[model samples]
Target chain A: MPKSINPAIRDFLDGRIWLRLHTPFTIEDINQQIEAGHIEIIQGIESKLVFMNRKSYTCNRCENTDQSKFTIFNCAKCEASCAYCRNCIKMGRVASCTELIVWKGEQPIYPTSHTLAWEGTLTPRQQQASDDLTRSQEINRSHLIYAVCGSGKTEILFPPIFHLLKQGKRVCIAAPRVDVILELEPRLRVAFPQTEIESLYGGAKPTMKASQLVLATTHQLYRFQHAFDAIFVDEADAFPYKADETLQKAVRKAVKPTKPIHFVTATPSDKLLVEAKSTGGISIINRRYHGHDLPTPAYISLWKYEHHIQKGRLPKKLTDWTNERIKKSEPFLIFFHHIGFMEKAEPLFQLIHPGIHSVHAAHPDRKTYVQALRDKAIPGLLTTTILERGITIQNVQVAVIGAEQRIFDKAALIQIGGRVGRSSAFPTGDFTLFHNGITYAMDEAKSEILKLNKGGGTNPDELPFM
Target chain B: MNCLLCEQPKQSSPSWQSLIAIEKSTLICEDCSNQFKRVDIIEVGDNIDSITSIFTYNEAMRNYLHQYKFLQDIALAGVFSNELKQALSKKKAIIVPIPMHPTKKIERTFAQVDELLKAADVSFEDLLIKTNQEVMGEKTREERLSMSRLFQIKPQVEIESTTYILVDDIYTTGTTMQHAALTLKEAGAKTVHAVTLIRAASEQ
Candidate 1:
């Protein structure tokens, strides 16, 4: 018969069993056990309890063990090797087991549930895209997933990404805007519940360890050097990224040599498309996911907001449209070509309807104001083209002031229209271009949308829209 | 080190290593060195202040500047700062480098002179602020001269009879330094002397 164990030893063993066997443990239980002296406290260590199996007794270095004669040895070379009973030598470098070692204290761990599962069926176009991404991944070739506005491009990426993660391959999705990264983070986290997903942008919490998947803005790509196995450049032609060669260099530098880079955009630049075609790996999804055609833009003449402001009045058509939206409690965005004009028009519209909110790049609380717009807490938002892409607000009407301005290029106008009619709940909305005269870019943008709407097979002149 | 421009052997005078390379083929020999007195002019008005530079604007200097301005090479700024300190050793005046437009600085992620001055351990003050001017490359010498009038001292910053040493990377026609000095004088500065990395040789 085994000798009766001491009461202190029994309590210590019980405490160890309680900690190791049970997870999501309560602090009250821990405090009770600590007060009973069943736990040994180690100060200055991170407040965590470490449990070791007490039945194990083996020499740490040479893996020799004697279960009946257990002892902790103080050897000088113990720093390099944990010296324990002779049996531990056979176990090889195993440390001696202690019972109920409690850390000082710990931050509360909240259990998070990941339940992001695909609920929607893939449309025919999305199915085709899914097929293409699989083929592209198998062949190790670059593929362009060109989907129109409101076409669940992010959702389609989930299937391929899930496949890659299962195979233990790393994936990165890079965009030019912080807003896009913010929008994609929660969606990605839900889709890959067990996989570690890192969202890297300015102001995001740094991941404690390297992750299998990452969502980062293009600027953040500068820090990575040939790290990712697959790279997806979203909004490939967006400002500062497209205009600056150094950012492009950074992207190229970050991507591994063997990995292929996928470009996703509603409107591809002529150069990018030409390169994609020449490279022989291109896939385009012309139709939106909503099953409705993309909106064809039309121009209305309204030259310079400055002239209207100086006259101590808002433009007649714009004011009438804005007042109707305000009366109906519908949220809307009025985009101006220039910041100066946007600033001038914002106050005039607010005076006409005091409930309306306006925001621009210079606003200190731009993020908060934009969130308010998204939540429909405000009726209207007056803005610059900074809100053109990477932001989604439900049931908002969009109008571009001074659409004929040189700054309002084809791609920009299309992206501004994309801001409207994004959600299935509010699938259709007005997208008007207020201009003194329709410019070539305006005509080009309208035609491009029409072409994309009609199955996208017209030999349209290649313009640098994206 | 050799003179980067003329390929002549550069000898450091007893004072500082940087002064010998400021201008092309223009070195104050040991005998003529006594004639060089530390000028305490607070404001650069009508008279031209003779300046000394440490290095010529050679390929290495251009590469260094390219890294400093475009690549955000913070480490290279340390070299620049040490060179500036050696060149302006005698001057007890506060060092003031030209200010960059806030917008440009934001885009570039750093101010060129701020990095240099911080690395060099010299006291810097915003004595002169840059104003809206045409692109430096697009403007002619006359245009640049007219445009230089825009650099002015802020009203709150009172430079009361204090000497200032103007620091800059390259001194081409001396238009920028001249305007800066004039503005400093207008703000009640006692004297202003210029020091740059390079000064183009005067045609004989």
Candidate 2:
């Protein structure tokens, strides 16, 4: 005979589809749950994740061919031959007999009538796009918001998300990058103070409790299956997420098989747009909420900037740019292409101005340094494209040291420019590219910004007051 | 050939000088192998005469063992075979494995310690059979202490009064090894020595 489960536990475990239970739960309690059929133990740590016959093998997660990654061995725990997936082995080996308790019982219903606490108003373009998203969400159909950089895409997502939350539908706002989640989490929490929200990323401590709204990275979506009623993919066209097929599949797998998926991005690849437009309606927001134009970038040649930085000497124009920003007491972000050059250039720029710092994706102090910049404790930061998105500083100036590098694709360049003029108080900033030679990507980035401006933007000349 | 962990090609210095420093059957490159902290504490208490373990079970070794044992990357059994062999008795002796019960063997599929010996090409007898089917992991330390008689010599197995070299994977608290050594000694083996690949390093 099985005992009735606590409702709190059910709500917490439901959307967590597949999760590992290590210490804290007594084995007797686990056995009782197993008897109750609330969750079936798939495989314990002793068992292999994939059970294979001699002829063929398959991975249940990611669904890749079991080649070099899956190696078979006579397992002592299961007393049988088994294979394991090497691809996701880093995420804790899923061998045969590995104990994976899955949520197999009824999911929790979270009906709420609370209205959104966000008092800010959206622009007419943002309002129209939000309405379109609401219709798409109602019909459980996919939609894409093809907004340009600095076009207030995050704010536009608020109304539709609020509508779904009131109707008791589970909503997930997934981003390809962790930095984006960090940037959006506080704002979303502020907007929906009455809603239970959870933010998840690689190192984030997962709040196992049931949440009406979830913010997660696409990589974190692997542990989720048929979880969300509506999934919104922010920065949908970012690197790895756009290039990697597995992450794309994870987004699809995360939501209920038939539910809606919305993608919000400033720069959408042609293939993504074409595919999305075929199945869903598309809306575009090309102007920033303040009706200001995207910053127009001008390129200047610095033929041997690398040599100059390594020799502890910066080019005169670059030095003058740094000094000018320092003199004006304005915060700035200088984008670098290569990590080695970025490191070498950091100290040189510090000599130019000791108040400056540098950061990269792998830096141990990246989060702290970014926070320092946000608090106005640092005058400027020398960083890689890691800061090109997810960071908004007041009246921050932008410059790309090696804009001609292959790493600075048109989309990345657009994002780098988008870093400027985000706050209404600082609706204008200098967007410059210091390049060895003008490349097609640089021109394409510039033309894209110009195109967005031509679509719908206040005349830059008339914004002199800003 | 490349280092298995870092995948860097093995760098060779002047030939003769490097050859003497390099051990034959060394699978990982020199720098990668250097990361494992070699332990000086080989033997524990009086019950076990002599023991040899290669690496201190530090965080790195813990992670490596986690991948090998729990992750079941059975291929790693080959990675440490040579190192494990050098730590074992060189003299002629019967290699006896600390057997897991049928229940545990069914769950894990392969006995981790036995696989380590097999990869080293050390001839061993799987004669020590586990009598208890209870899991050590789910029990308290007191329950584990009560499990002193969990293993026994297989029936009809001839005890030749010869040397016995017992094999196991980890030596945590020395309980599991003590049980195996005492079993072999009482069964009329002249001498009993044990070899473990990693021993638990006291926490900092």
Candidate 3:
């Protein structure tokens, strides 16, 4: 005999029955299975447990029994091709798995989930901020929520997003990088378990149907025409998007005429901040969620390196720096102005310290080398500007081999400096610049750091170097 | 006669157009025209004459031309073509827009003369093809004369050379058109003449 189960759980299990069974079932396992809706309990052992369930979905053209396998379902009504997979339905591409699990349903049709709730516990400030944003949405007033880096900005939007989803409003979160979209996907999935959240990017699932909520890069918004009720542009001052007019137009064109647009950034451009302040829509949350202070920048000059390198000699300053780090068994990154110069310096530096390893963009084993460095399998990495953003390594000091080169603009120099003193465990380290002469950009970057130090909103005690 | 080259009047030739004035001497106009002619004709490959422009690039003409080329005022190309259309209206030949090299077309977006010719409502054929050539060095009239045999006719063009008029944006020194004319003649043409948007006015 098997126990009875609720119809909703039974329906869910019926759709995904393969998840339930182990072939030679024990008596106890069978009873548990009946309770779990895997097998229906019968009154008599002699009577067979008949599996009775309606076909949830069927391919009209191929007549395939498995709904999960077919993405391109032929429609008998219009004789058109339709996507059955969730990703395919959202993005129109059959790239990810084809599990026909209903995340949400509306008016007897399965509606894709866009806005989801936050499952994790929120702090008092975050909860309040979330509530404030939700209330602003109800009144149709645009609000700018400015939170510091690592301030759980995404989590704070969950409650507002959930409210919007309940109200059947379409939302979109647009960022400048594909990496940011990828990071937000899983977090959103867990929060809106019932909502169909589509991650839209160059490589994301392709579909013709508009998703309720789309997490996309700014470029992806070009195809959307006033589709979203609320559009959130993350990292508003990030490169390519910030500099390009087409991307700005796409962001504007993707949002509905009467809907709200939210801009989020750690560093907003002067133009954007001015506009936000003038409109009185700006709200600032100046503290990190983890309550840590932003890192203070340090500058070092190795003027003798160029003179020694020209003479086919390694500078004592570089050798001594490496030797001390080796003695301390600490890892570091040697940033270079050009790949050609970096290649020349690599072999010579390796001769001085045989254990040292260098990697660059053109290296065939770049991924392996990066992984090795990340895993602390190598002593150091000699690299170009490619590794300047969106990558973090534990406890690694940073050195710019030719910091005075014109390529090291203020933004680039600041980003490179950011790579150092990031981890809380090893939050303080020496950031050196090996330059033949100091440049104006370097001075500007250092001055900007001093300005941030004096800004007063940041925690003064945690910035050890300051 | 006034010399076409130097614009000096010559007493030897009484006819106004029969004499060409050199810097220091007068040459007979027939002799000057013959000197400009080369026995060997250069072929305007099948892709080259697809869109031919008229207007000898000169200092005076270049001022307006810089506006068309650099400033991206495509409207000026239309104006230049209207002038060209007016010049060619007397003749009954199809207006072949000068074809730009594929690489040049990509950089410049649209060919200027092609747009001009089309705007003028003249019938044109995309017949000539251009093969890339290594620029040897700056060539003078004599050097260009010697190098006149370099261009070759593309096969299977089926051109009515006698009725076809070779068009180009400019006719500076008439070297390119001379070669193009020779090539058309080799492809069994009966007669060939050149028309440019501007002829350098006789200086004298």
lDDT of 3 by residue, A221-318 (tens): 75455567788887776766887665777777677787888887655665766665666566555544544544545556676676667666778778
The best candidate in terms of lDDT: 2
For model 3 the local lDDT of residue B105 reads 55
Model 3 is docked with a DockQ of 0.01
- Chain A alone, TM-score per model: 0.72, 0.90, 0.63
Q: List where candidate 2 sits over 4 angstroms from the true fold.
A: A1-6, A19-56, A61-68, A90-92, A98-106, A203-208, A304-321, A338-341, A353-356, A436-438, A456-466, B1-204
Candidate 2 chain A has its poorest 10 consecutive residues by lDDT at A457-466
Docking class of 1: incorrect
Return the top candidate by DockQ. 2
Report the C-alpha lDDT of model 3 over B13-101, residue by residue, as the tens digit: 34444344222223324333333321122333332332233443455455445644543333344444445555567776644444555
User: Comparing 2 and 3 by lDDT, which wins?
Assistant: 2
Chain B TM-score against the true chain B, each candidate: 0.71, 0.82, 0.59
Candidate 3 or 1, higher TM-score = 1
Question: iRMSD (Å) of candidate 2?
Answer: 2.4
